[model samples]
Target: MSTSLSSDAAVTGTRVSPPSESRLRSNLVLVTLLTCQLMIVLDITVMNVALPRIQADLHFSATGLSWVMNAYTLVFGGLLLLGGRAGDLFGRRTLFIAGATLFTLASLAGGLAPSAAWLLAARVVQGIGGAMAGPSTLALLTTIFREPKARIRVLALFSGMSSAGFAIGLIVGGLLTEWLSWRSVLFINVPFGLLVVVLALRYLPRAERQSAHLDLPGAITATSGVAALVYGFISAASHGWGNATTDISLAAGAALILAFLAIESRSAQPLLPLHLFRDRNRATAYASMFLAPMAGMSMFFFLTQFLQDVLGLSALATGFAFLPTALLMFTMIRTIPRLLPRFGPKPLTMTGTASMVAGLILLTQLTDRSGYFPLLFIAMILMGFGIGLAVSPLNVIIMSNVEPHEAGAAGGALQTLQQTGASLGLAILVTIFGTTSRGAGGSVQHALVSGMTAAFAAAAGIAALTFVVAFIYRNPRPAN
Candidate 1:
C-alpha cells in the first residue's frame, strides 16, 4: 500500500519521483488519476440527462427533481476543502481509495433506490465521497510527476479529461437514459470506480502522513458558510432573491465566511491557508478558475434547456450537440503544453478568456430561428477551446508557487472555488433567464430564447472580468 519512490532518478529533489517504470508506469499513473477524476466530473452532468426519468419514476414534483442534482453539488462543493486537507494530513492514496470505494457504493445505492428520499440520500453520500477523493487526484499527480516536461504533458491530459468529462457525461447519460433505464446512469459508476480503486491500490504511490491536526473550527465554519451560500444562490432561482429564506441564508452564509476567515488566520493548521492567496499568480489562477467554470457550467445548464425546449431536440441529440465543444477542448489541451513555453500563462489565459468572451457574446445573439450549424456549433467550439487553454495553464500556474507539501490543500482550494463558482453562476443566470422569459410573455420558444440570450450576455461579462484578471497576473520568480 505504501511505496517509496525516492529511488527513481526521474523523481528527485524535495519531491519523491517514481522508479523508472518509464512510459508504462507513467501511463498507469495518468490513467488511474484521470479515471478517478472522470468519475467525479462526469457524475455532475450524467444525472442531468436522466432527471426526467428520475422524476417520473419517483413521482417527484418538478421543483423536487432539481434537488436530485443540487443535493450532490451542494454537498460536494461544500466539503471539498475538508477532503483536500484530510488527504494532506492523512495520505492521498489512502483517501483516494476510501473515496473511490465510497463513491462506488453510493452509486450502487442510488441505482437501486426505491424512492425519492433514498436516491437523494444516496446522492448526498456520493457528494461526500467525491469531495474526499477529488482533490487528491491532482495532488497525487503533482507528487508523482515532478519533471516539468513530463508534468506539463500529464497536466494537459488531466485538464482535458476534466473539461471533456462533463460533455462526455451528457452523452453517456443520454445513451443510458434512452437505451437502458435511468438507473443505469448511476450504475455506470460502479465499474469505473472499481477500476480506479484497483489501479490506485496497485500503482499509486503512498505519501507519509503529516502530524498536523485538522482545523476543526475552520472546517466547520468554512463548510457551513459555503454550503449556506451555495444553497441561497440555488434557491434564488426558485424563490426570488427577496424571499425571506434566501435573504436569511445569504446573510448567514456571509457571516459564517467572515468567521471562517478569522478562524483560518489564527488556526495553527488552517483548513485553507490564507498565505496561499498571497502569491499573485496563484490568486489570479484561483479567480480565473472560478470565473471560467462559472460561465462554462452555466452554459451547460441553459444550453441543455434551450436545445431541448426551443429547438425540440431529444436528450440524446442534445448531448451530441456538445460534441464539437468537447472535441475542440481535447484537441486544444494536447496543444497547450507545447504552447506554454512559448507564451507563458498570461498570453494563454488572456487569449483563452478572450475566446470564451467572444463565444459567449456570439451565443447572446441566439434567437429561436438560429440554426445549430454555424452559430451554436462555432460558439461551443470557441468556448471549449477557451476553457482548455485557460484552465489547464491556470492550474499549472496555481501549483507553480505551491510547495510539494501544500499540493493537496492548493488543489482542494482550486476545485472548491471552481465548483462553488459553477453553482453560484448557474443559479444567478437561471434567475435572470427565468425573469426575462417570464417578463416577455411571448411564445415559450421566444421567451426561452430571450432568457438564454440574457444569461449568455451576463456570462460574457463575467468572462471579460476574468480576462482582466489574467492580463494583470504576473508571476515573479521567488528569490532563491
Candidate 2:
C-alpha cells in the first residue's frame, strides 16, 4: 500500500522529525480530510430537523419543501462518477480544494438565503460540491496511508465518522435550530470547510494529473442513470411507489444504467473501470456495502420519527436520544484496529450483522407506549456495536487492493453504491411502512407503531441477508 505523504510516514513512523512534530503534522492531515468527510455526511441529515423552520422562514409550499433535500440528493448522487473521473484527470488535491470551496460557499449562501428558490439553488450547488469532494476524500485516504496498519486505523475513523453522522446530524440540527436559527445548520460548515481548504493547501501533497482518456459516453450514461435511480427513490419516499412519476423515474434509471454498462464494456477508457468488478472478493464486498446501509438506514429513519412523533420528545431531545448509539460507535473505532487483525472480516461481519439483526428484531416488538429505556435503549446499543464492527472491514475490502490509477473511480463506485443503496432501501422501507400502517386496524398511535414495527422487521431481514452474505466467504483471509 502506497500512502499520500511519504513524508508523513517518515516523520511519524520513522521519526525523521521529532516524534511530536511528525505526529502532529500527520494527524492534522487526517483531521483535515476526515473533517471534510464528516461535514458532507452531516449535511445529509442536519437539515431534517430544521425543515419546519426553513419552510416557515422561506414561505415554502409543501412541494417546495421536499425539493430542498431532493435537489441535493439528485445532483450529488448523479455527478459522483464524473467527479471522480475529474479528480483522476485533473488531480485529486485540486479537485478537493475546488469542491470543498464550493460546498463552503454554498453553505454560506444557503444560510443567508431569503427565499425558497434561493435556498434551493444553494443546496443544488452544495450537492455538486459534495459530489466533487466526497470520492476524493476516501480515495486520498486510501492513497495516503500506504502502510496497511495505518490505513486500517485511519479507515476505521472514516467509517466511524460516517456511521455516527446520521445521529450527529439530527443532534446538530436540533441544537442549532433550538439554540440559534435553522440557518446555523448550514452556517456551521463554512468555518470547517475553510479550515480544510487552507490546511489542504499547505499539508496535502499534490499528485500529477493522470494521462488516461475521459470516457465521455460512459460518464454521461452513468451519471444520468444513477441520478435517475436516486430521484426515483426520493420520489418514492414522498409520493409512494405507485406514483406515475416514481415509476417513470425508476424505469428510466434502470434503462440508463443498462446503457451505462453497455458503454463501459466497449469503451477504450471506461469512466468506471469495469475490471474492478472482476474479482469475486471485491465484488462481494461492494454488494455487502450496498446491502449493509440498505439494512441499517430504516432504523435511523423510522426511529427518529418514532421518538418525536410517538414518544413526545422535543426536537432537541430527539436528537440527543441517539447519543447512546453515537457514543458507543465512536468508542468502537478505537478497538477496530485490534479486532480486525485478530478475528478477520468474516467473523466480524457476521457478528456485526447478527447483532444488528437482533437489535432490529427487538425493535420489531415496539408498541406506542414503549419507553426509551429497556427496549429502545438496548436496540441502540446493539446497533452501535454492530455498525462499528461491520463498516471498517467492509470498506477495507472495497479499498484495499486498488491500483493507484483507479483509486478515484474505486472510491466513487464504493460511495455511489452506498448512496444508491441507502436511497433505495429507505424507499422500500417507507413503502412497507405505509402499506402496513394503512392495513392495520388501530388508532393513529397504534397505526404508526404498527408501521414502524413492520419496517424494523424488514430491516432485521436485510441484516440477516447481510449475515448470509458474509457467511458465504470461503477460506477467509485476515484483513491485515
Candidate 3:
C-alpha cells in the first residue's frame, strides 16, 4: 500500500498531488509529530532549573514563582478541548502549523521578557499554542498509522519521547542557565518549533474538518474553572487555606466545573463526548493519567528545591540529578508494547502505580544527612521506570478504540487531564510545602526540607489512588 496520505486540497491556491509510494515519508510523518509532542511536553519543565534565576532577575516572589509553571499549564489544560475540536472542525494540519508558528513567536517573546508580568503573558500565549497543537499531534498519528502493530510501536515511541522531554528539559535548562542564561531555555524552542512547522507543511497529510462546531462556552467554563482552582490553591500557599479569597475562588471553581459538566451533557455536540466515558479501559486510563502526573510533576518541583536548597547542589547538578529517571523512563517505555499484549494494561498499570507510590514514600523519608545514592537515586529510578510502564500503555489504551472522528477530542481530553493534573498537583503540593515550612524553626534549610517531605507524603497518597484505579479493570481488554 502507498504510505503517503491524501493529496493536498490546495497550496498557494494550486492543487498538489500526493507523493509517490515511500515508507520513509510515512516514517517522517511519525517523527515530525513525535517531535512536536516532545517540544510541548519539554516546555512544562524546561524552565524549572532556572526558576531561582528567573525569580531573582524578574523580581518574582517565592510563592509567585510557581505561577511560572501554573500559568502555562492553566491555559494549556483549559483550552485543549476547544483546540482539539477546532482541529476536527477545521483541519489538523492547518492548526498544527498555525500553533507551531504561534508557539515559536511566544517563545521568542518569553526569552526577551523584561519583567515577571511580561514573561507570564508570554507563557499564557505559549500555552494557547500548546493547546492548539498538542491534541492534533496525536490525531494525526491515528490518521497516518492505521495498522495496529505499527500504531502501537509509534505510540510507544511518542509516549517515551514525551516522558523524556520533561527530564531532558531539566538537564538542558540547567546547563543553559548555568553556562549561559535562563533565557536560553525559551530560545531553544524557536528552532525546533520552526522545523516542525516546515516539515509538517511539506510532509504531513491534511484531514477534512468534521461537521462539528467548536464549544466556545464549554471552553470558557473549563478554562476559567481550572485557572480559578489553581489560583485558589496557590493563594492558599501564601494566605493560608482559610483565607476568604481562597474559599471564594474554590467555591466558584467547583460551581463552574459543575456547570461545565451540565453543559457537556446537554450540548448537541459536546466538547467532550459523553459516550467516551462509558468505556471502562479508556476511563481507567484517563483517571490514572490525571493522578499519575500529579506525583510525577511534584517530583520535579520539590526535588529541584531539595537538591539545590538542602544538598547545596547547583542548578546544573540538580538538573543532572534527574537524568537517571529520564534514562530509565526512556529505556522502560520501549518494552511496554511487547509486555502490554501479554499481561494487559491492568497488571502494567497496577505495578507501575505501585512502584510510583513506593518511590514517593521513599522520598518522604529524606533527611538532611541522607545520601543521594541510597535515598534520592533509588526513588528516582523507581519513579522513572514506573512512569515509563504506566504512561505509554495508558496512551495506547485511551487512543486505541477511539473513532477517527473523535480522535482529536479524545487526545484533547487525555492531555487536558495530564496538564491539569500537573498544574493543580503542583499547586496543592506547593501549598503543603509552604504550610509545613512556615512552622519549622528559623533555619531555611529545615523549613524547606520539612515542606518537601510533607509534599512527597501527600504525593504518595495521590499516586496510591492510581493503583486502586488500575485495579478497577478487573479483566484486561485487548489493546485493539
Candidate 4:
C-alpha cells in the first residue's frame, strides 16, 4: 500500500526549526534512537535464548519453532526499502514515532499471545515496525549532524550498537528468561518504546521534502521475492533440500527475484535504485557486508546452544561468556576514527575480516570437552575485534558516498542485505547442523562442530575475496 502524502508535501508540511540549545533534549533524542536500534537488533538473538521456553509454553514443534525468528526477519528484511522510502516521503520524525507506537503495541500483544499462531503474527507485526524505524535512525542522524568528524563519531557508535546489540541481547534475554519468564522478553519493550515515542515527537527535526514517489511494483515484487527466498531456505532446514515443497519454494522465489530486477530496470522510481551499485567500492562493500555477517550470525545462534547444552553453563553464565567479545567491540569502536585516518578503510576491513575468519576457524576445533578459558573466550574475543574493526568502517564507507537525500534509501538497502545474509546464513548452517546431528545419533556437540567448521571455512574464503575487493576502492582514506 502506498502512503498518500507526496515528498514535497512532507518537506513543506513540516518546517525546520532553529537548532535547540537543550543538550539534555538532544541527548534524549540520541538515547531514544539508540534504544530503538538496540530493540531491533536484540530481537534477533534474544528470542534464541528463550526458544526452548517458548516451545514449551506454546507447544511448538521443532519445525514450527524456527518460525518465531523467520517470521520477524522475513517481514523486516522484505519491507525495509519501502519503509525507508516512506520515511523520506513522509516526515521521518512522524514515521519514527508511528513505528515506535506500533512496535510497543505489538510487543504487548506478543507477550499476551495465547497460541503459537498469535505469537508468530505479533512477531511479523513487530518486524513491520522495525522496518519503519530502523532506517530512519541512521538517516535522521545524518541530517541532524552534518559535520564530518561529528558524524563519523555518531555513526561509529551507531554501527557499534548494531553489531554489539546482538551479543547484549543474548545476555539480557538469558537473565530475563532465568529470573522472570520468557514472556518478559516481549513485555520489556513497552516502557522503553513508549519513552522513545515521546522523545522523538519533541526533539527530532523535520527536513524539507523532495517530490518523491513510491515505487509500488518494486515494493511488492521485492518484498515477495525476498520473503519467498527466505521461506525456501527456512523450509529446507527442516524438510531437507530435496523435498518437493522446498524445490517449488526456491524456484518460485528465484523467479520473483528475477522479475523484481526487470521491474527495477524500467521503473520511474525504483525502491532500490540500480545505479547505487555502479560505484565499485560501494558494490564491494555491500558484498563483503553480506558475507561477513553470514558466519557471525550463525556463531551467535549455535554458540548460545553450546554454552547451555554442551558446556553445562547456567543462562546467566552463558551471557557473561560473551562479555569479552562485547567489551572488545566497544573499545574498538572508540578507536575507529583515529585508526581510519591513518590506516584507511581498505586495510582495516581486510584485517578485520581476516581476524574474524581466523577466529571462526579456530572455534570450529571446539569439542564438548573444550575449556571456556581458551577455546570459547579466546575465539570470541577475536571475533569481536574483527567485527568491531570491519562493521564501523564499512558503514562509514557506504554512507560517505551517498547524497544526503538518498541516505535513507541507502541505509535501508545496506541493512536489508545485511539482515538477509544473517537469515540466509542461519538457515543454511542450521540445516547442516540438523542433518549432521541426525546421522551422528543426535550428538549436539558433533553436530555443532561440523556446522561451525563449514561456516568458518566459508567465512575465511569470503574474507579472502573481500581483501581483493577492498583493493578496488579508489580512495581508501576518509574525507577530512
Q: In angstroms, how far off is 390's CA in candidate 1? A: 1.6
Per-model TM-score versus the true fold: 0.94, 0.95, 0.93, 0.92
lDDT of 3: 0.83
Q: In candidate 2, where is summed lDDT lowest over 10 consecutive residues? A: 1-10
Q: Pick the candidate with the highest lDDT.
A: 2
Q: Which residue window of length 10 is worst by lDDT in model 3?
A: 4-13
Clashes of each: 1, 3, 0, 1
Report every candidate's CA lDDT.
Answer: 0.85, 0.86, 0.83, 0.78
RMSD of each: 3.4, 2.6, 3.0, 4.6
Off by more than 4 A, model 1: 1-22, 475-480
Tens digits of per-residue lDDT, candidate 2, 1-480, equal: 222355544443344766565566678779989999999889888888788889999999998898888888889889988898778788888999999999999999999998998999999999999999988988888887777888877887888888889888989988999999999999999999999999999777677788777888888899989999999998898889999999999999999999999998898878898899887767877888889888888888898889988999877998899998889789877887778777777888888889899999999989988999999999999998897787767777777778777888998998899889889999989999999999998789899999989989988898899888887664467544
Candidate 3 lDDT, 31-55, residue by residue in tens: 7898888889888889888888899
Evaluate residue 54 in candidate 4 and report its C-alpha lDDT on the 0 to 100 scale: 97
> What would the per-residue lDDT of candidate 1 be over residues 1-480, giving only the tens digit for each residue?
112232332343466543445455667777888988999999999988889889999999999999999899989988998898999999988999999999999999999999999999999999999999999888887778776766666767777788888888988888898888899999999998998899888777667889989999999998999899889888887887888988998899999999999999998888999899998777878998888888888778888888888888888998889998888788987797778766778888888889999999999999999888799998998998888888877767777547777888999999989898888888788888989988987688999999999999999998889899887677433111
Best by TM-score: 2
Of the pair 2 and 4, which is ahead by lDDT? 2
Model 3 residue 140 lDDT score: 82
